[model samples]
Target: MIELSEVMLEMKDIIKDFPGVRALDHVNLKAYKGEVLALVGENGAGKSTLMKVLSGVHPASTHEGEIYIKGERKKFANTKEAESAGVAIIHQELNLIPGMSVAENIFLDRQYTNGPSINWGKLYNETEKVLARLNIYDIEPTDLIKDLTVGKQQMIEIAKALSLNAEILVLDEPTSALTDSEVDELFRVINELKEQGVCMVFISHKMEEIEQIADRVAVLRDGKSIGDITKIEDITLDGIITRMVGDEVDEMFPKEKFERGEKTLEVRDLEVDHPLREGEKKVKGVSFEAYKGEILGIAGLMGSGRTELVSGIFGAYPDDTHGEVYIRGDKVEINSPEEAVEHGIGLIPEDRKEIGLLLTRNVVDNVSAASLSKFSTMGVMNEQEERKNTREYVDQLSIKTPSIDANVATLSGGNQQKVVIGKWLTTDPDILILDEPTRGIDVGAKVEIHRLMNKLVEQGVTVIMISSELPEVLGMSDRVLVMCEGEAVATLDRAEATKEKVMEYASGNF
Candidate 1:
């Protein structure tokens, strides 16, 4: 527990606003030395906006806020000024040059030099010291960033912050992409930092993670502080969630039962080679089937070949993939995404920004991108028809945006995800493959998406999902397939699939 006298960072009376939105309204936060303070909220609850205010991404003049470190007020004009003031934030998306070496990325833009030349030996040696301070021994200073795992890259991000001698650290969804074992390692390092009197502000949408690591919890709702920061032991998970969402969340999963219909999609002995590695197989001899009017869930840990299996089936990697896919009792070949789409298959990829979204485009363009043929005549698009169709979907999905003309990037994480789903739905596919559909989204959005899935299944559309969250799989799936090491090890019915059972299969424990 953190003592009251040891407050290391405090953000008081923060009020930030945009053109039509008051993102943060007089919000306050405090973090004490040697403790983890968790900031919990639904999407669009001003959590990211508040962090931007603190990190100088919004700037002091832009947001009305006062920040203090050790009881001394500080004004930061930019991120460099914030870093100079002993503040550092590791964003949700890692910001590192993948082609560079670890040492080079760690000391990016600020290199050790002798006159006009970089000091290679001194730079690597200094990087080694920073890594050693964090008890990281497996990664060498000269290793390429792309060669390392996601977890190792996260550690390097933390090391870079520590290299700047940052006293207050802010982590934004640090474990969102990590494996279970990797999350454990990250928690271990977090504990180590706590012992060294480094104050941390953790922002996450995960409830289990809050229970595991948070000493105190602060909830934000509709750009306002829900209440005072409360001790973790004094509140229930439901209580925190209620504070965040401003309502009783009686049913987070809301799974519905539907009659299973005929077999809609089937795959046999699917194999996909790793995109980069020469001889390594990502998905090896995997087979699965999805039935109409049912949601089939694929469960596994990260890197357990869950994403690769679905991608292979969706024809994301055509030349390197070999599989026999059958849709509606007839064997079909899917050599590309276009072929899969034409065969009534839709895939919502895991990485929404990289593979799913057009950040710079508007909602109408993004939604109609896959099905422009319906709104086009003589090779020219009908703009009014496109807008009307997009508006219909925007209302159907309850996507929050000022206008259909607003850039997709302006919406929150949840809304952006809905846009991706809307894009695929325009194609009117019979079989939907959703890879991490609810990943990194807030509780409200997750429930909404689940409800939409229920609606789809009731209409006889086949739904197949791949998720790392075990509880989601157990709650929503009629049948769950557990994968481990590029193989489908077990298939369990919803009645028999518990978290423990799924984890056992996912870890290859038999």
Candidate 2:
């Protein structure tokens, strides 16, 4: 463990407020040199708000706070001022031009010049140095950002921050989209930066990542710091959870068992072609079954075809999707999402902002989007019916919204996700498939969603879930289906599925 001797950054008595909510209330934080300080909280617990206060997204003039860099009080009016003060923040949604070259993106807005013209050689050479600081070499500076993997693009984001001579780095959910090996590489870079005495703040919802990389942990709840920053070695995971939510979490999973029942949905030799690459398949010859009164989990690594398999069955990916989907043991033809819905199959897609939500509309509109026909007759709409129905699901799901008429985008990540689930439940689907339903959500929200899943199963609605978190899959699944590189490799009952056994199959180890 590194000694926390030198305090590199500190925020004191920070109080930020909006028109109707107090985002941060007298919160304090400290980060030492050469160490990773983890800032964790439930969604809307002021983690992002606090970071914005520090990064000057909310100008110092707007918030009541005093920030100090190495005992020198500093106030930044803008992000550029924060950067000038040796501060940099990398948001989860990367801020890079995908069509440009790595060198171009890193040095964009201000290019290295020779006389009156841009010096190509000097700019590329400077980018190489920044990449080397992270010990990254295989990725050339001249490579197009679009050609790189998600993980590599994430590294480039860090490289851009370092290029600005940023001394205090803040990474927000940096590993949310990365593969396991990519996460390892990111940790390696972080360690290297720590050795160079660069202070770092890591914000994440993942407990395992915090345990692996953080030196100290601080919890936030309801816009207040729960307690003092405690050393990672001093606090148990249970203790952290308690501090985060202000209570003991008895069982995060809360999986309730159900007796084996009739089959509700089945897929035979499902195949889906790649959207762009010809003759390539995202999912190849995958088959699965979901039974009433049970949760069937699809577990796999990134690119293991779990999402594609469900999407193909749901008819969301219609082109070249050759699969025989059976509802209640009867074969059916599904050519589109509407057909799938008509067949009593509901899908909660993975991408929330892009596919699952209508951000510009209110919660009532989104909840009634798929089942508007139920609330209409003769091409006329029944908006009162829509509002009444929305209110019921909002209450049932415990979705924290100002009102049913409130814009869906105004809610927290967890609440927004609940709205999506509410939309599908209105249809009263016989079978439901959740693709990464708990992803990017807080532990509290995750627990709520899992409990809802159990409730659905008890109600006899078949639940099929796809999750990348192994612990979640192990905790909640009645049976686990392992996939590897477009193939369904193994199916194991909960009694026989261990982490080791599942990983072995997922990794194609037979």
Candidate 3:
């Protein structure tokens, strides 16, 4: 437990501004020697900006603030200076190189060298010691990062921070990509860190996790601190939520019943080979059907091949994927994304930045990208029609952006997701596939997306969604397909699909 009297880190009167808006306004926060201080806020509520200020991503000079470490006021010029001051931030995005060795990634840039050569013996020894200190012996220093699961990779990140002698650790949505067992393992590591007197600042949108892990909670709203930080014991989940949004959240999963129509899409003996590994299969012989006017949820742990199954149906890997797909009871050949789109199938890929959105382009460009043929004529472009369609979808989806010309990367995670969905909708797909639709967004945006799914199903669009979040799957899907090790193990209706049963199938126990 952390002592309330000893303050390890403090930020007072912090104010940050971007061109025409204030990103953070007079936000104050403190952390003790050993405690998890959760920073809770809605999307665009300045939580990320505040952490950036602390980590010197926005240098001390850039933001108006007074930072005190162990009662000494210090101004950081850059991220390096913050690290030297014992502050380390693990971003929401993983930063390790996939092909590199774990030890090399941990001691990145700072390695032991003799004359003109790196001492491989000392390097491996140091890495082993660090990993041992974290009570992790399963991973070796020579192991490549790609071989480790997402949860183990997260541990390596924490071990790297500890190697820097980081006294203040800032974790930004660390559990966003972790499984249930992995989250449990991470909490174990956190508890160990607490005993060692490491102060942690946790940022998450999941209220249940906040309740489980935080010693205290601070709420941010519209660029300002809502009130004094409250002890976890003193604050209710509803109370913290009200402070974050400044309103009561009546329902999070706003799902509605819709009449099921004919089978829109059906697959038989679907298989997808691993893109890089020659003989390995990412998705095995999986067979399922999506009915019009209904939402079909795909549930599995990470690496269970749920995403690959949908991607195969969408023709992501043509050379290695083979499946018999039927559209409205007629056999169809979709060997590529273009052919799939021609057959009235649309897919919102898992990674929005890498697979879905063109970050450098404007909203109109991204929204109209998949359906360019509809707006263009004989190789000539039609800008007016594209912009008109973009505006209509932006309004329909309630995408929070300044203008249709704004860059898609500038939008929030939820809005970026909406833009991707809107882009797919423009293709007029008979069957829509959404993978991890609400992975990193806040609760309000999650609810909005759920409502949008309800609306889509109501309009007779067959929706196939893949989610790691079990509550969302059970709440939104009429039928759930559970995958394990690249195979569809079981299919359950809404009434029959509980969290335990889903996990059972996902773990390959049933």
Candidate 4:
């Protein structure tokens, strides 16, 4: 069937290089006009690089490749040129201004003008048309971008992309931040687009999604195409993963048990007030306990206040939070992150780039950031000691980098997360709260992070994790705490937490 359709997009020998690294090596791709081509690969395997070349983010002269649209070759100078060529990309990280209205953000550069002055009414009306095209009625065009939930912002990103009327659309980790209901809506829109003869290239690490939504899959490894484009029905999940990692993959979770120790941290009647809305709370009266040798997974849908609860306990918003925390039966005063670190608490935030890493710096600097005192004397710095300490973690955590001095921005998603973990590990905390620790990384990297959690637990660290992925919570958590809205609806033991049961509690049906 695909063979009968026209080739909407094609790439031949795409070679993308950055400094000394060759991100893409003679990679080739082909997609039919109405079909979805799934691009699956491990982090650092050149998926993003190849997409950049195609989307004109890298530009025509930056890479060695021939990109053809509808059997006609194109040379794009910038993103606008690519858009003119009917190419648009929705990046994993949303490109939206928090202060602007949705209408302004959607048609930012190309606003509808009435002679010299801008016509605000026309802008809002055009934005409404775009939202209506996506069947997104909940969001108003006048709404500020920051007021929306992440899921809604993500939907707005899709609406903005679709408004371009792209003939060849690239969705990079589009569903990573989306909820299940939003995902279903997105799939429905995608199917509608397929019927309209719009070609799509989907890049995701979630295999189940690829199997569900993709017509064909193309695997990449070490900056090269592993095999030819194959129909999604012709391959198993295991087969695709094998092509990705270049070997037979083992147990996905790699969960190991350890003896439960004393209660290391306890939260009683914790609440975090909304920063923007008066009398509204992001986290309600939530209570939980974490022991010395177990992974406590918090499961909930997006906007369920899971992150707020952990951040409140970590003293991230101590001024606006009301909570009672006990560390090993000792009531301590923790009104700031410094005090939390002094009380032996470390939190890995859900958004690593925004809150975790110093992207402009190197691995050594990021690893030594939280524990600078250890490598400093009398307000002076010790670069050697910092590098030595970072090297130890690089080896211990198996972090992949060109060197200790490699820029944090240059590393892959998995390695960036490892760097964040290594940063917290230097603090030597008794309690570690990881919010979406393995969010966007591949299956291989996820297993490594899970094993690292087990290692931390065995070493007498109390681990608290929040994951949107239900399978990860069920597979790796010793106990699952289900949250609905801002309340803890249920806390089930490992044996009691099934996918359906957890969803029931999370959906507020139980």
Candidate 3, position 88, lDDT: 96
Every candidate's lDDT: 0.91, 0.92, 0.91, 0.90
- Once all C-alphas are superposed, what RMSD does model 3 give against the true structure? 1.9
Q: Each model's TM-score?
A: 0.96, 0.98, 0.95, 0.93
Model 3 poorest ten-residue lDDT run: 1-10
lDDT of 4 at 149: 80
Clashing pairs in 3: none
Question: Cα RMSD for candidate 2?
Answer: 1.0
Give candidate 2's error at residue 388 in angstroms: 1.0
| Model 4 clash number | 0
- lDDT by residue (1-510, candidate 4, tens digit) is 454379989999999888888889999999988899999999989998888888888989998879999999999888888988888888888999999999988988888999998899999999999888767788999999999987788778877877787888898998888888878878888887788788999999998899999999999899999999989989999999999998787877888988888998888888999999999999989988889889999999888999988888878897889978899999877888888988999999999999899999999999999998888999999988899989999999889999999899989999999999999999999999999999999877888898899999988899999998888899899999999999998999998999999999999997
What does the lDDT read for residue 276 in candidate 1?
Answer: 94
The list of candidate 3 runs beyond 4 A from truth reads: 1-3, 97-100, 114-117, 276-280
Model 4 — TM-score against the truth? Answer: 0.93
Error of 3 at 417 (Å): 0.8
